[model samples]
Target: MESEIDRFPVKSLMERYSITRSVLYKRLKGLGIVPTKFGRQSYVTGKELTLLDQLHDPNCNPRDVNRWRVD
Candidate 1:
């Protein structure tokens, strides 16, 4: 059987990235990332977090998540 992938809560991501809910949602939408819902809460997979990190700009402000680019 395949091992379960690590999951992170959206609230934790907000704290980790220092972004607001709207900003996080916008960033996720821009990046074509869809959060997995569990009951009333939302979560992101480790793979998705990696993708976010890969696209993240260290120099840019955390709130400026739009600065992240795929290309």
Candidate 2:
């Protein structure tokens, strides 16, 4: 299968999520998704972004979040 995702760089993620770098890292850590490193920049997959959305959405149940978590 193709591995690449519609990834976003750290700067764009920060702007899109309105989160600081520290918070972004923490959230990524919580989701168990590793960011792809390119030189000094870090990028996250669209799948990861969806997980973050579920995590932050008040309408989403906590159990639903766990279903998508990476090993």
Candidate 3:
């Protein structure tokens, strides 16, 4: 049993952070992470983000983060 964090849309992030689309794009670029696009929009995988965060710390690279890509 584990808690699941959901994926967030680009527009949702823009509104939540009170930032423009360009700013969001810039931040993503600065972070060196690219999202996987599904359908006609872009999306950030919450699991991937968490995994990256853990990996970024250099001392906590976890073996797995819960996520399944349906295709």
lDDT (Cα, tens digit) per residue for candidate 3, span 1-71:
99676676666766765668887666566555577778987777786455444543546423332232112
What does candidate 1's lDDT look like per residue over 3-71, in tens digits? 765888877877887878888887788767788999988888887787676545676465555555343
* Per-residue C-alpha lDDT of model 2 across residues 1-71, encoded as one tens digit per residue: 88655887866877777879898777777678898999998887888877887776778775554566778
Q: Estimate each model's TM-score.
A: 0.67, 0.68, 0.57
Q: Is candidate 1 or candidate 2 better by lDDT?
A: 2
| By TM-score: ranked, best first | 2, 1, 3
Best by lDDT: 2
Q: Which stretches of candidate 3 lie over 4 Å from their true place?
A: 47-71
In model 2, how large is the Cα lDDT of residue 70?
A: 77
Please identify model 1 stretches exceeding 4 Å from their true place. Answer: 1-5, 59-71
Global Cα RMSD, each model: 4.7, 3.9, 8.1
Clashes of 3: 0
